[model samples]
Target: MPERIRFLRERAAMQERARLLDGLVERERSRLESLAQGNASAAMPLLDLYSDSALSEAAGLPLPSILGAPADSRAVDDRWAAARFCMSLLRGRKDLYARFPYALSEAADKNTFLAWLQSDEGARSTGLTPASQMHVVGLFSGDFAARARQAFLADARIRQVLPHGLTPAGQHGLFGWFMQHVWSETETHLRREEVLWLFMQAAENPRMELARAYEFTPDWQRRFPDALTVFGWPEFASWFVRHYGADPRWVDVAVAPEWHEPALQLRIGYGARGAWSTKYPLALSDVGQARALIGWLGSPEGDAGLSATARQWCQALDLPAVASELLKPGVNIIGHFCYPSGLRVSVESIAEALGQAGVDTSLRDLRTDAKDDPHHVDFGGPEVHDITVIHTQPDPFFPESYARSDLAERTPRTYRIAYWYWEFDSIPDAWVDCAKQVDEVWTATEFIARGLRERLPIPVRTLFPGVRLTPFEVRKRSDFGLDEDRYTFLFTFHMMSVMERKNPLGLIRAFRDAFRKDDKVSLVLKTSFGDRHPAELQKLRDAAADSNITVIDQVFSPDEVLSLMNACDAYVSLHRSEGLGLTMAEAMLMGKPVIATNFSGNVDFMDDGNSLLVPYELVKLGKPIPPYDADLEWAAPSVEHAAQLMRRVYDDQAWAREIGARAKASAEANLSLEAAGRRIRARLEEIEALRRQGR
Candidate 1:
């Protein structure tokens, strides 16, 4: 009977201890919530209570309650205790401000910060760099914590990784440390989603084996493209190495080519599905590898060595072993390659020319899919190369296609070149900075290069756009189900390019004034990207409501578009300005007389001897389009004059045919693939000569 009584007493004592621990945990959790809600008055007390000894003493429990808990403990006692400690250390506004210093400065910044907190991908947009926003559950009170916990538990990846389950201490310990380290490593492009994904993969398996991760065609690669970049984070890598040991897959690292060694250089980037592929700098999977190469290239010895290595690699890879950097160096031209638009046509033409010039040219698509030209329609995958040629708008923010957001700051050590243009007399302020950064500024025309050079310190080169007239399958008016009896006037414009620049409305006005309703003249307004500007397209439709205007809104394949140009009686462009007037050149190459404003870039190739150049007067812009200053003047072709020219082309078929024949001849002499190839070769030689002379 005495033994039984003693056992009951001990049982009661144990129950009391358990209750004490639960109560302490509850109190700490409450304190954390208070702090999270901006109760600064309770912060110091909460901090004191969260100390190791204080927490242990208050709970009447040992450190092992949390430190040695199972992976999947859903219980709140020690979980709350550990969560409280983490919260105390990193819960308040101060903690957030510390990570993102500008978060609370301006109203916009504050809104952005709060918006991030409320976002579905909070970790991606907020102070929780490497940390998952799931940790925020510990920072709030009542139902909020429960909801967060439930959501976290629901994640498939998390569930897969945590078979044993998540303990509060484990969450706080590893995650907290990782996040802190990530916060310190500023200037990283690592998204919070990517970190969480990496952590889950690392934690679930714990084996840390990474061999299959880098495989050229790993099964998991299609699902997890960002897997490799995670290893670039030193904190995660260090922790992973310590816990899981070095990955066996990394055995190839020892054999990986040195920075200056003769090995194939694969230029890769991220894709639409967030998978890293051989696209552009944006999809770059191996940040650490690139950085290592960058460091080496920054040194003179490394630079010389890499230059020699690039040539050797080119030879081994069966790429064009071009002249050295002094002339035309082997270049990786990164842009929208397979896109079937006029701009893409120009880009492809340049790539072909570069190839013909004996320069190793790899055309990388920007991972953009177009019905006319899907991703990698021309060339893709890993290859040997040197230098990076970004062919897009200079400003990273200005709807730039090839300007990879990450490359804006993480400038490569190679001879970076930006092939860009602006419509105005003075380049945009943003473009000036971009130009200032690049080794060379390649403009499509002397007009643009001269304008930019006046303001920029960088050397500007006139790299005239190449025109390649490949024989396309002949398509007729019936192919588009158009009126076979009517004479068709074709005009093409991309909506993404500002409407005011393309001046489609002006063209519509000229066409309306030129021909009568009874006249057998139909206008084909070839428009693309109508979805982006529904209202503008509507306006165009409204303008053409009473006329014989056939609007082909859908993007057509290059062969079809070229055929459409061929079927047209004449091509007309009342464009205010063009970078190179690629479409005008294409029309000329197709044996079609081009009626274009005799100003800006068109003047580079258009002339009265071969084509009709509509006289234009310089007109001031009403409002400033960013990059296009209001003070600058663009050609405003007289609508009356355009109408007169159209009448002459219609009434005098023999004269038009004569002009068309000359246009084809002019295109052959000035804008042919061979001519462009020669130009590229000459320019490359000049660059090589300059480099050899150490100029």
Candidate 2:
């Protein structure tokens, strides 16, 4: 006989065996049921659970004659309920029926098989464990899905591939693989419900087959993008539910991890964003069009469309109608203004500068509308702005904040721009991918731009940072509760920033070494968000011990902080690195001579003519510094040189005043609000020109 014929013969033999076994069990079950007819529980047992009714009354009787039944005899629903009640009495439980074996078979096919397995003759003949007996029940259930589960579980090839864990997730993976084989062999298209039923049955028990099925499936993530639209196609939907464990939702698609393929996740995010614009629709007939929309939405310009709100809007209208909404022109700075973090302050400074230069600018909090800070500015409506300035860290801002900002659907015509800042030489891999998603990338300094331009395949521009320092009443040492006549050396740092990189320790060490316990000079270490870094705060306290250092661990408002800075004789920073050191610039603007490490982003403004540059040797980082690793080298400021500068500045008041004046002049000339505004407006104009050309 041919191999195909032999295989068919084996399958047919198994089917015949199953049929014979089922018949024997059914006959024995019926005989036992007759013996248990007198039992009280058997008097419409299942029906009584719903409502008391006699078995005789339910059997082949009109439902209305029974208590609370529908009056109409033609009511199929009432008739079926009555029929089910009568059937449940016949289907007996262990104590309900005297002959439980017969009752079990009547209740369910699996129950009958289980009863047969427990019998002395059946147990001796089968020699099956309880788990094995359950497997057999699935096998003899007379359904392809049940048989498939048994065949897959029993297959030697499958057992070898099965992983140890039988978690629901593991079962899903196995089913995803098994589904491919099941679908490929299926002669007729199965309904989604039918496919779901098969999976539901297979997942009832853990067997080697599930692992085999999971291992067999190839490039499951590749099928995901198609899975969303191919809902009617049972195979795709089955695979999707198994892998993802839910119907495809916008949040799941937008934030899928690497295992799902970041590229696909990115496209899904884009597609989800684009679907909001009147130019785009939630549902597309063409797969190619859907994919294009996804990719477009994922881009920087379409970032606004990915929000939950955008999705809700798109769901209500088709693409044609959404596209018909007229667009407005003018630049909008969508950033983190709701908080008083460094990013928020930076964004506000840029926006204020642009306004000063007569540029039409507005502010919109992208991810959050949180009205926490008293200083947060309202930019009117997010819709009125045409050009978007995404002020954030590249990878982080894009993935978490910008991806859900929902600007694309709201202002689809706006030319989206990203102003990003990074401290280290190389950007994160995610950031590199994000750079291309926008039309142009802006950096605060050329130092930052140089690193980005070297790797990013996008237009990169340099825009210097601007500051709006509010003038506070010039307070004496007595005003801040400090001893009068003490020459205060102020060192301010935000605890939110990396304490090690900020090198507050270096300043503390230098301060402690330069000044004596009895010296009239005081070192004021003003830091905020101490709770975030309690360990660092403690370390600071320990260093300040036995010295004339006043550690102010408190959050001060803008004016209060300005008063503190203005009260100090000089501002000092012995930082290991900086990304446009904002405090140092602010100190310079205040005509206060700054002593800082002559390395990294601060090099953009810090020069020998205006500020004291501490000499340092390039040293490898002691530990992993996020984007920069142990291999990365940064300046380790000379503590000896810092001490010398501190003492020199304290002794020569006239020289310090002259340097502070020059520092102020440099800041006014280079970091003025007008200068940044001019550069930003020019860039926006270029972007607008390009947008017009593309149109």
Candidate 3:
């Protein structure tokens, strides 16, 4: 009796659920019928009752029957009724209409849809919503053949709409179609506005085959004589010369009164070779354009390019004055200026110091890959300089990497210097060979200089690049999502610099061992380029998961980097080795206590008095880590020693402050811009004296 009672209750519950489902189904069916009858207001409530997938499945059958049925079978009124119902359904849920039930490839169905789409009523229906219009175009895929069909259809639609103006959706659809199909293939009669629109669109789109629109230029020029003003003369000239082979007509148009100012601006701006200082320089291939520009600047219009001060200084200088000024000697500090590497900072510091010494300096950014920090500062300089400082690794220091044909031709008398940094004890033979190409080598630390001097016959000097900190804003711990109350220890690095060398996993272990999850101290690992080494980054993340640790894989500007260092109470680097330990020095400059391994280039500035020097064991690398071979020896820092130092720094605030103050004094004295400037000036003077003696 008990079992039968239980079974009866279960059956009753199932029957009640079935009844509710039946009611829902009936209501949905009514909504679908209303949608089919062109009553969108009644059908809109159905969306809440059913999921998008469910409503799409239910409405799929009726939509195709109304729009895709054979045209001959339906009378004009019946066809209009079908079109209205289709419009209502589309309005109800426009996103569900991406896939149509009928074959779009079928001629009858396509014609039926196209006829309705082209009609006045169809335009009003689609024009009601951008989504509806977008869905209509979405029916045609963006494949080459599909694009051709869409382009043909758009030509007719655009021609009709050309009298007024295109809606945003229409413009978007037309732009898409034109990007894939050639503009010449369009049968629409070209008007001045239409030609200008086409030219501007093609010129702006990096993917567009701009050469296809070259035929329209003559018409554009004939219609609008100052068309270059509208389409930016420099950009147009770049394309014009690329396609038309340096025509004098375009040159005259470029230097015309209306367009001459902008062209002169481009001339005074840094050229394509990344030479920030050189005026009116172009790539070797762009010499024709450069020559034309030079010719124009040497003419009466040349005064437009010069500043008032320059004009007064030269007394309305003609070609000789311009030539003399353009040919003046300056230092070209070339490197990966855009990258967020230590090399970028080194190059920037060198440039700043040279500028301070009253030596004219120009920066050339050689990095071709995506910049790590888009907000990185651009230090503009000259097009031509006499001395070339190549701050890069020896492997990529060849002419092919830094000195392109154009740079080589311009710097025939350049005094080449390689400012290199290496962390290893022994130098690579290839590096030694590459060093011969430069007149001398400059290194930031005596450790690197000693190795180079022993190996190379040429001069190898220890010249520390200046360390200057000008933070944009004083960022608090809360700005970086760090706990304000907790004493934070920051470790910043770039994963592209090599994971094993940075040893972030070791830092994580040390941090975890040093404190508990509830500890009032926190660790923030500010790093970038971790995406390239997912496994290593994942390992670090897993190790720090249970601790008061935050891993920030991002890029920061130079100012932001200094601000980050300012936010932290103490900075830590458990690195196996360092080229110059730029970040460590930056932290020291910010008056933060630094806890780093007592090894490599950092040891030049870091000592027992100024910072916490963690003990390390010298060990040979068991496995090859690219730049550092298996046999090369590097410091293996004691994690226990680092952990103890971190705890001590957190406990001893007054002691930490004293150490930080000492660090600031040491960094300012040794790494100041003035000191670096003095060193660089004396060296440059020596080089100049030697050059004068005909060495």
True-structure RMSD, every candidate: 20.3, 23.6, 19.6
| Candidate 2 TM-score versus the reference | 0.52
Rank order by lDDT, top first? 3, 2, 1
Q: Candidate 1 lDDT, tens digit per residue, 324-424?
A: 22122456676766555665777788888877777767555653422323233224322223356667676443244332211121222446677776665
Top lDDT prediction, candidate number: 3
Mark the regions of model 1 whose C-alpha exceeds 4 Å error after superposition.
1-329, 338-340, 367-386, 397-412, 692-695
Q: For residues 185-294, write the lDDT of model 2, one tens digit per residue.
A: 32353322233234433333322222223322323322332222211123443443333333333113332222222222222333333333345432232344554454
Q: Total clashes, candidate 1?
A: 15
* Candidate 1 residue-wise lDDT at 170: 27
lDDT of each model, Cα atoms only?
Answer: 0.56, 0.58, 0.59
Per-prediction TM-score? 0.56, 0.52, 0.58
Candidate 1 global lDDT: 0.56
**Which is the winner by lDDT between candidate 1 and candidate 2?**
2
RMSD in angstroms, candidate 1? 20.3
What lDDT tens digits, residue by residue, belong to model 3 across residues 470-572? 6469989899888899999999998878888988888888887888777899999988878888987898788778778899988787777778878889999
Query: Between the candidate structures 2 and 3, which one is better when assessed by lDDT?
Result: 3
